[model samples]
Target: MTARWWQKGVIYQIYPRSFQDMDGDGIGDLKGIARRLDYLAELGIDAIWISPIYPSPMADFGYDVADYRGIDPRFGTLADFDALLAAAHARGMKLLLDFVPNHSSDQHPWFIESRASRTNPKRDWYIWRDAAPGGGPPNNWISDFGGSAWQWDEATGQYYYHAFLKEQPDLNWRNPDLRAAMMDVLRFWLDRGVDGFRIDVLWHMVKAADFPDNPPNPDYRPSMGEMHSLLQLHSTDQPEIHDIAAEMRRLADCYGDRVLIGEIYLPLDRLMHYYGREQAGVHLPFNFQLIEAPWNARGLAQMIAAYEAALPPGGWPNWVLGNHDRPRIAARLGEAQARVATMLLLTLRGTPTLYYGDELGIGHVEIAADRVQDPRELREPGLGLGRDPVRTPMPWDESPNAGFTTGTPWLPLNPDWPMRNVARQAGEPGSPLMLHRRLLALRRTHAALSIGDIRLIDTEGDMLAYERHADGERLLVALNLGHDPQRFVPPRWARGACLLLSTIDDPVAGDGEALMFRPDEGMILAPQDNS
Candidate 1:
């Protein structure tokens, strides 16, 4: 139940390669992130989560890490990363790096030697199996990106498994030696003074012991299918994962104050277990209902209730509206409805994560097939496919390349950059970016907004409302998700509350007729403390 600085802090996720490019090699680098630490500090965020920056071939971007201890030359040297850490700390912000232990790049030396020959000492470091009697994979499992998860290696005359792109091979965590090596990877970064880690695909660390064949899903379809569905019973998300996580918890605890935030998209009830019994597991497991939920009052309210109820008695709750793996919130909720979604994310009873460009209300882009760089898209040409759209560069200015790089960017900038860049929006009072800044500052100023109890208030269609209370302080929040004005009767508790903030262009009296809320509008009201 102890509240650490990170537990109550807002964590901003910056995909460094797409955040900015200092050397103009088109790729975003650590120096670019250093330049933007001020921007993050200005936003009033308490922490920043930088995606993988380790040595890699960019196979799965940086997720297929080639080295666990050093930075890739493409992302700049270890010195550059050290400087970035120093800059972030100087601004009083914590840094959380992404830990991709589920897999490693086949080009990684460990995997190279493991694949070189069966007699290699590190051969058991990766999963390898001989062909069945009929000369095929031992079991059927699908890769998340596309196609079969098993890849035939003629060098070893065996099949190595990958849950994502083939170049990123799944590690054999079943081996103690491999687990120890991965633990060392954690220690290496911890020694570098990283405040924490956002553990990628944490649930997929262990697989079914028997390699059981997963049944086909009855709801299967070709359109934007979950690669997980090809196998009904996931070989991933095994019970053994908890123990692995416990070991990771022990490792993290060795370096005090460092936490492990997990990325597990399971339903709330099941997701709560990742925190482990007796608070011994991951510090926080992400609740991703917003990404996969229907954007409506009923659906969202129900998800909120479920997540709130499922949070462990003393456990912290975390919410994520969107991430690199999904469409931007602006695109999903429509540009006009984006702010309504933002209010819910910021006002909810949790430490919310704002994806890099979401504060600017950036929508998804459409990248042509020939322009696609995602390995998943390249391999599976037509599958409505490609993640390039959401992973575009952040718009920092109106200048060429949107201040992302002097040279062409790794991915094209969103064409709406002229209007959406931070430079233009930073000074605009009505811009979503400024609104986000105000909301974050408000959260920091109000104890009820930061560490408080949540109560979902009943409301009509397209309207979401809730209350956050702590000690004698109480704050009520409501949003109209549509473009047209909507009315709501003030609940008894909110009837006497004073208006604190609103996204509306024109304010309306809280006591007035119907309490109308304009489109994409939200308001925060502080209740009179009668106690």
Candidate 2:
């Protein structure tokens, strides 16, 4: 039996605005992406998941979608997207678009009509309720981006709920009409031959039927985002979400070979249900443990073990090191360990999602205050919550704009672009790009590294070890994830094995007696004569 396309595929994420700029308008457009299809193809990713490109108000950087079925003019028209999709398909790569169903931009026609009057025919399309007895917000829910979740709409004489920015009004999935409309939006794109969708904020689409204030979180800390201030009991992740996910699954199945990727951040127990009540949920409930777990060996080991055990039967796992919203692995773990992260992600049991620019080791950049475009930062100043540092443009070469654009980029490039650009790293030995390419190539020829079963190998402090086996082929992945050097005594199962790939290209990777590992070194090894 053949595995599904998503089962063994590696997904690459592109923040389109920062990917490339062809029109020289200081923004990345669909045409610019099409121009770089060859580059991504060379990266060896099986699928490309581009962030939101739909017509949006830019309140949350494309999350506040103004029109569900139209492309944002800034990112070019539907024709450009069609061409890009075709280009990607021609290269044997799949394309996944970011789909936002939880909310719509305040400017959306539905929202406009819904807020025009309390008696508007579309008033039920959004979550609106009468203000409290004191004319305050209807509930105590808070926005994920910050502040109260309810926005007072004087024109409609009510408070409408917004889980993010006020410009992003939450849609009422309880309303059959709105659900049908969103489904049609998905159909419109599916009809255009796009491969799939990464459903944004998938768990937040449905809210408690009864309006109630969320209880204050006992564990809330000032360091955490403001949304954590409440327990979110009545705000999100409601039971009805299962049915909605099933609906989405049914729709995607209508187009054979299509996938549904959900963006969910809940704990493993809660997150697993997205796979479906009867194994009919999303094709992949994105596992973000890598992003949220501690960088230490113990933290990651425990998390990985728990996640592996929690997965539903026959559910495929995925690993994500970084994304547009999170800090880059290099930025968090330094360039050295970022290599280990790459090896770990690629050699893991399931799909691996790579963030653009990570393969070149370009991470967080210092953005000047004036050039900051993230509204979450502007709204909650001094919270150290801005995501602009990680969403900078991809550095292609040492051109004036780092070869991303002829004009000034929307945000500053990584400070080290002059040396860390992809053009230079593509040729340099032991470069981050080369390491990624080698691992990707290995994955192509080694089924044991992809679609394999994983077993935890015992190791001491600051060390993580695991085995991936399939069809009698076995490979061991060992890593020292700390600043202190460590030693690895190969298990009996790993006897007579040699290093397949190392973080620093160390020639002798567990080939002989107990080896002394350099700080932050990661290695993949195959048993002698195993293949």
Best by TM-score: 2
- For candidate 2, report its TM-score: 0.98
TM-score of each: 0.97, 0.98
lDDT of 2 by residue, 151-176 (tens): 99887688999999999999999999
- In angstroms, give how far residue 298 of model 1 lies from its true place: 1.6
Q: Residue pairs in steric clash, candidate 1? A: none
- Cα deviation of 357 in candidate 1 (Å)? 0.7
lDDT of each: 0.85, 0.89
Candidate 2 weakest lDDT stretch, 10 residues: 506-515
Q: Which stretches of candidate 2 lie over 4 Å from their true place?
A: 509-511
* Candidate 1 wrongly placed segments (more than 4 Å): 226-229, 232-234, 509-514, 528-531
